[model samples]
Structure formats: C-alpha cells, structure tokens
Target: MPQSNINRRTVLAGGAAVAGVSVMTAGITSGAAAAPATGLLSGGRTPGAVIPPSDPRYEVLITGINKRFVAHPEHIKMIRSAHDAEDAVRRAFRQGKRVSVRSGGHCVADFTCNPEVEVILDFSEMNAVEYDYRRRAFVVEAGARLYNVYEALYKGWGVTLPGGICHSVGIGGHVAGGGYGLLSRAHGLVVDHLLAVEVVVVDARGRVRTVIATRHEDDPNRDLWWAHTGGGGGNFGLITRYWFRSPGATGSDPGKQLVNPPKRVIAHSFDVPWSKLTEAKFTRIMKNVGSWHEHNSGPESPYRHLSSLFNVNSRAHGRLSLYTQIDADIPDARRLLDDYLAAVMAGVGIKPVATTKPSGELAAMPGFLEPRELPWLAAARMVGAPDPVGANPEARVGLKSAYYKKNFTDHQVATFWKYLSDPTLTGVDSTLVVLSFGGRINSVAEEATSSAQRSSVIKVIFQNIWAFEKDDDRFMRWIRAFYEDTYQHTKGVPAIDDVTDGCYINYPDMDLADPQYNTSGVPWYTLCYKDNYPRLQRVKRRWDPSDFFRHSMSVRPRN
Candidate 1:
C-alpha cells in the first residue's frame, strides 16, 4: 500500500490495448449500428469536443480502463470542458436515450461500458489538476487516474491524496466509491478530505445544471457531498470535478504532507505445499491474523504504520504469501516484520519459509511486474461483520471476510486449511486474500463519509483465477457456492447475524440479488453501502430518477 510515482509509460501502455480500436470500422454503419452523435446541448460550445460516432476521433474516445469490457457503444461523446459535459447530458436526456457515463471503465459488472447503451459520456479527455496554494486545496477533473493525481499533486505541490493503489483506476469512480489505499489508514477515505464537488446533475425536466457543493458548515448541499463519498458511481450525478480539502497541520509547507516514499517495502513469499498445511495451521493463521487485525484496529492502536496483505493462491505453483508495508525505515521495518511473522508462526504452529525483498513505493503500487499478464477472469466472495474469521468446511471456493475488533483468532486459522484442501472446490489457481483495514481509516466517524463500514477491522477477499474463458462458469459457480456454504455454517451461530454485509462494489457480482444465492433478502446495496443505502437512494432519485445510469445492482430509488 505504499505510494508510488505515476509511470506514464506503464499507464499509456496499459491503456493502449483498449485505446487501439480500429478507426476504420468505428463508424461504418448507420441506424442502430452506428454510434450516437455527441449529446452536447447547443450554446454550450467548448474548445475541444468530439461528438457522435461519426467523428474521426470517436474510436479514440470510447475506450475504457478495462479493455475486457469495452465494446462499440451506440454513441460516444468526448467532452473537455464542464460546459461540454453538461450539454452532453442534457442532450442525452432530451433524446430519451439511456445514458451511461464512463470514466475509468473499471467496473467489473460492465455497467459503464455496456453495449446496449445509447450514449456514453466519456470523461477521459478532461484530465486536469490545479492547486490553490493559498487555500491548500486542489481541483481535480474526474478523468484523472489515481497515479496521475498522485504525481501531479506531488510534483506540483509535494502533497498526496489518499486514493486507490491501482495506477489505472480512474479518480471518478474511486472517489465516488470511497477511495481506500495504504494512506487510507492514516488520512481516512478520499471523501474525508473532499471539500467540494462540481457536478452536472440532470433534473426531472431533462435539463442539466451545474451545482457546486462545499463541505463548509453553511453549505446547504453538504448532504450531497456526503452522498458522493462512498455512494458508488452513477448514483447521484455526474461529478465533473472535485475539490480536496487540505489535511490539517501536516506541516507549514507541502513537504509536511508528503512522506518520502518508504525506502523499502519488504515482501515475503511462502509456498505452503497444500499437503504440508494442516487444518490446525490454516485455522490458526486465519484466527490469529483476524484477531490481530481486530485488536490493533481499535481507536488506540498505533499500528497504522504497519500493514499486511496475504494472498493464498490455488495456482501458479500455489502458495500462501504475505506482503507487508512498514512505514518505518529499514531497521524498524525488520522488527515489524519479525513481530508479525512471529505472531503468524505461533498461531499456525508452523514456521513458514519466507523470502523478504525490499521494494520502492512505485513498485508496490503496480507491483514489480506487470499485472496485465495476470489472469483477468476471477470471482470472489466476502464475509463481513461479527463472524469468527475461521474457514468453513462446506466452502467449495470459500472467501471468508472479517472486520477484526482485536487480533485474529485460532478458529479462523484452522478454517483456512480445511477450505483449501478440497481440490474439487478450488482449482489450482485460486487465492484467498486478507487485506489490512482500519488504522487511520477508523479515526474518522461513520457519519463523516459515505463509506459507513469504517469500523471494520480487516477485509478478507477470497478470489479464484482461471486461464480459459470457457471455465468462467465453473469457477464462478465454485466461488458463489463457497460463499453460500460459508454463510450457512455461520447461520444462527454466535456473533453471526443477518446483517453481515455481502461484498465490495469493485468486485461486483449480481448473484447476490438472486434468491438462490442470497436467501436473506438483504438487498445488494447493504453489502456495499451498509446503512448509507437510504441516503444514496435519495441522491439517485434526485439526479437520475429515470434510472438512466443503472445496472443490475445499481442503487435503486425507494418507490
């Protein structure tokens, strides 16, 4: 979770695959097959604009953050100015066509890049970041990538904002969904620092108006700002830009807010041959780690400087590896590593052979190697709240998650082994990840932002990766079954209740809405939004009452 400088080449290269669409065929068809024209309203002229599928630049405009999901949209409009954006939305609403907004296009559910859409308001053209030295704030366009924002702020003002780790994730959705990163434990969610937002909201009359809401006490639209914190994308409105509030008294100048990227982030890998790990060791690791997470996540823990993420992979020489980031220098980092390793060793009752390598902050953001070569097809299940972080025997590809109030437990440790033993349940390429949560993240109150899951201790992401597209059904079913089975095991069990939040928005899977998978009738938003769903619904009603920007699991306005 260490911060890294934005590597333009990597980003451009990563984005090139999708951006390299064939211009020759971009607008060869007319009628339904042809792309729609720019939905910009008249009189809102802009310096740079690409309207409709007929434009020669259309092919370059429609590509998204995720190439896997990008397809030919009926229409794509690239807007550079806020006025251009407003005109596009107003035009789309007037035409009675469905409008889908695309920023990074990283949504796994394909909500932003759906092929059936009539129009796409692509924001990739509006990348800009301006700093107000006097106010200690910065204005960032939604199109900027997390890495771009990081580099621009650091190089221009020596400041950083807490955002996602992935260099390709667009700031648009990241901030809207409550951005979390290594810095989150120290600075809180991105919305915690959001001071104001410039949004283009569509009214019931199909008119688009620009609204500016600030975090000031007297700002009447403060609730609107709250809704954007973690409300998820396309719910309230199209956020054209965001103004970040300055961190309080980090230092007199920008250097005070900057942490010299960690000198070395030690990464350790341990390949626990499936046969060598016992149920006891697995359960112990889960429980101990879960317990440790709970214990240190409380209001009093100073462990924010130390964080760890464990990946249990079912394939690629299957291994259980731990990656930890220590905020201290080299010597203290060694001690931190020793202490953490000792805790895990004691809980699992086995000495894991670990290889520790030092890496810079940039390497940590995207990893030393390219993740593009990594498998794209993967499915995951998450268990949250009050559950003992133990593994479940019935889990076919089980992903058990927990928010520790203290440290992990012994029971959870044993469960890890039992869950991974069933080869039929998990293929050779599955992974179980335990990511660090809390720390500085918990310092902020639940009401301070839209991400109400602030009290969570840790997040367990059980994921399975596959090589062939044909195996998609099999792998997904396995993951879903594992999730259901784990839930059953905890049903009516101590400390486990119906309120268990289901999953993260970034890993969207609509199966949670199906009665077969979620018999609890706990709407999808509850898993991602917790108690903040209602407020989000109001925002949805106010902005997109017609439900133009919607997907299977999008926030639904209350009837």
Candidate 2:
C-alpha cells in the first residue's frame, strides 16, 4: 500500500499488546440454566454454532479489524439473537472462562481480543433491521453493520440514522460508544435518537437474563439504557439490540417519526500540494477551521448543514486534503460550500486557490480536486468503503484522539508542524485529522447522557500506520511523543482543562490510564467520560455487580 493512502480499517481498529488475563470461578453455574443443545435461548433460537481452533473460519473470526492483534480464543460461539447471547454468556460463566463479545469485529483496542478472553461470542449472524410496532421504533440487532442499518432504514422508510462513515462498523459498539457521523452536526448523535436497548446481563446470583431498558422516565431500568448511551461497550453487559426513535417522535409510524434521509449529497475533495504549505500557512488554515466551527456550532447555525474533515498528512506524504459533504437539499448549499471553502483559505497566505471537477488526475495547483454530487445512499456507500491496506497482515497501526474546545495554540500548531516536517520520522504513514464538531450535538445537555463532551468544537484523531511489526516501537513512540507534546500544557494528557475537553471513549487508548504515560494527575475515566464516570460507576455496580464484562478501559463498578 502507498504510504499516503492509509487504510480506514487501520485507522479505526488499531492494535495493542495483550495484558495478563485474570480468571474468575465464583460465578460458575452449569446445572439448570445450561445452554440447551438446540441452541435455544429463553426467547429465541440460536444456531449453537461453535468454531473451535481447528475450524477453518476460526482464524478469520479471530482477525480483528486492524489485522494486527489476532486472538486465539478457546472457541467461538455464534450468537443469532439475544437468547443466544445469554446462553453463550451462561456457558462461558459456567466454564469459568472469560467472555468477550464481537459484533462488527472492529474494536480499536484489544478489549475483545485480549489474552483474558477465553470464549468469544460472535454476533455476526444476529444482524437484522426491522420496524418494531410495539417499540414504536426501528429494531436493530447488535450484529448489524452501519451499512446494513443505513440501507435497511432508508429502504424501509426513507429515514436515516446519522452514524459513523464506516459501513462495516457494527452498531453494537458504535451506538454504545455514542456514534457520530457526517450529519451529526445537523441531527446530533446516534445516541440522541436511541430509545431502548436489549442487553443480556448476568445478575448478582450469576443468573443470565436479557433485559430491555428504555428511555421512558418511569422505566425501572432507565439507568441501564442511559449507561448504554456513550458509556462505551463491554461495561455492563452484552448489547443484543437497540431501538431507535428520534426523541419527541410520538407517532408509531416509522416513516413519519424519524428524520428524513437527505435528498441529495454533494461531495468535495480539496488537495493542497506540500510545496504550497508552510508552518504559518498550516497554522492559519487550522485556526480558520477552529474559529469557524466554534462560532457557527449552534442548533440554529446555518453552517451546521456542513461537515468537513481536514486531513493533514505528514510532509513525507507530500500533500494535505479536505473531504467535505453537505445535504444538497438545504437552501443555498452551493453558496454555503463556496463560502466555507473561501473562509478556510482566507488567511492561509496562499493565492488563487483553484477549483475544478474531479478529473481522476492529480491537481497541479492547491484547490478543490473533484466536486461530485450523488444520491444519498450512493454518497454514503462511497464514504464508508474500507481501505485495502488494512487487509495486509504485516501492517500494524496505533491511534489516539482528543476533543478541542477551541483552536490549537501557537505552540500546539508548531509542534505538529515540527513533527510532520521532521526529516528523521520516515517510513510510517502518519497523519493528524481534524473532524468538524459541535453543532446540534451541543444543543443537548452533557449530563443528559453518558457522552459528556458537549462543549468541544473540534475532535482530533492521531494515527500512525506502518507495514512492519519491527516498526511497532518506532511508530508507537512517534505517535505518543506527538500526542504528549500536543497536550504538554496538560501534563501530557488531554485533561479537562482550558484547551482540551478530554478524549473520546471509542478511541480506547490504554496509555491514557497508565501513569507512566499519563502524568496529567487525572484519571483516564475523567478524560474519557468526565463527570459521567461517577454515574457510570453507579450503573455498573447496579447492573454488573459481579463485574462480569470488563476491559482495560471499561467502567469500574462502585467500590
């Protein structure tokens, strides 16, 4: 793979070293609730599919999204429904084995593919999307990928759930971690529309049962539902299904209740040659983005209809680019696009930014490369395609993330430029991507859900993709150094301070929890969940008193 075109899979599901696995035998139970031979759970028929180490598909099932950390579970059980999931959990508990759940197989960290994971409950077969009359919302099974969810919703009722751009991302973990996407600025987060969830949880007595929790104010299990929203997955239980109905939608008619899919989408790509970029120029471009998003990120801002990603590739990559999209059905979309582009380059110390149609050719000048318009579904598919480099078994990647309340300081900007332009940093494909944030999402109260990051204007993702295991140390050291330096003001971590609002939980970096790396004097949970951590701990205690499901970054039960 070319170093410039990094794989999205690697970007999303990087790798980490395996931590020691802990064993627990107190929760064991095998007599009455033993999983039936028919693979039937309490409510549904599961396939009872088991792929042992000898099975040919075991290797494929064990390969994570990044193809970096390949787990070797004792066995893999396929879950077809909530009942199946519960059965799998019961068996794992009875066997005194640690259980790990895999939905889309895209966890960025080693949460599900760790050494402690003995039994793997694979949800790949449980994918199903349909409207549920009783729930008055769309019922999405945990195994469903974002692409399946989008297609099902759009085709079934001309509605859409604004989610991540990756089609292959599983809804199980995505929604649980407070999923966001291109339209998040306009529609808020996917969690904003979450109404209920079906989870298979182990009780205090070690009994496995499925619980359906909803957002209804009087629902006895309301906290369970709230914990699923941005609480991050694998904390309380294994999520089996999610019910989505936009908040305030009273009608049971799925078509009329949910947000309508965009009528059309306009996709634009801007390519800036490295020769045209300087430290000052780069700083100006980023400043424009930071200030623009901060000022315009409101429920009523016209710019909320726009979302763009500024991908700053290392100077070694020889170019920088912007991927932009907008709902064309909005009024004055053309003018909005043009004005936004103009504003980004307004003070970048560059002249005559060129514009042209996408001609399948490299741009000789710094300007918009290709401007193509497509129907909503087509555009969505194009955006979510995985990068081929991710399939390379030899490739390994590492990721780190942060949310910014405002523009980067001069020092931060200079640090990025210095690292990117460094002559010594070579071979690794590194990039700093700035995603547009804060719009309708900020309209919601931070305390309303587990996702407490409502004030940030921009979210940053730091990535380093390399082709050799030998380069792991070098790549990790480079990325960590970059991240530490970027947040040096906060003691090498994005603590809840003036410039940073903590980190995104979905990124799941264990380094933030290690005192050796995080000298910020702030607990990693504070950086990931902020004030919501206490509430999460309470819910964790209530729902998972035995601490059944957990990982390095999973929420801890109250002491």
Q: Which prediction has the highest TM-score against the true structure?
A: 2
Error of 1 at 500 (Å): 5.1
RMSD of each: 11.2, 8.4
lDDT of 1 by residue, 1-559 (tens): 1222222212110000121111111111221111221221222234345466787866654544323345466767765656677677777778877777767655656577667677787777666666433334566778886666777766665666766556656788888888876656655678878876767776677667666666666555666777888777777677777767644645445444333344334443343444566666666666667667666665556566566667665433345666555544444555665677667667555555433321111112224121111110110001011111111112222233433344434443434454656665646546666777787788777667777777776766656644454666787766665555555544311122332334556556566667677676566667667677887788778766777667667888766
Window of ten residues with lowest summed lDDT in model 2: 12-21
**Whole-model Cα lDDT of every candidate shown, in order:** 0.57, 0.76
Clashing pairs in 2: 358-370
**Number of colliding residue pairs in each model:** 40, 1
- Indicate the residue-level lDDT of 87 in model 1: 70
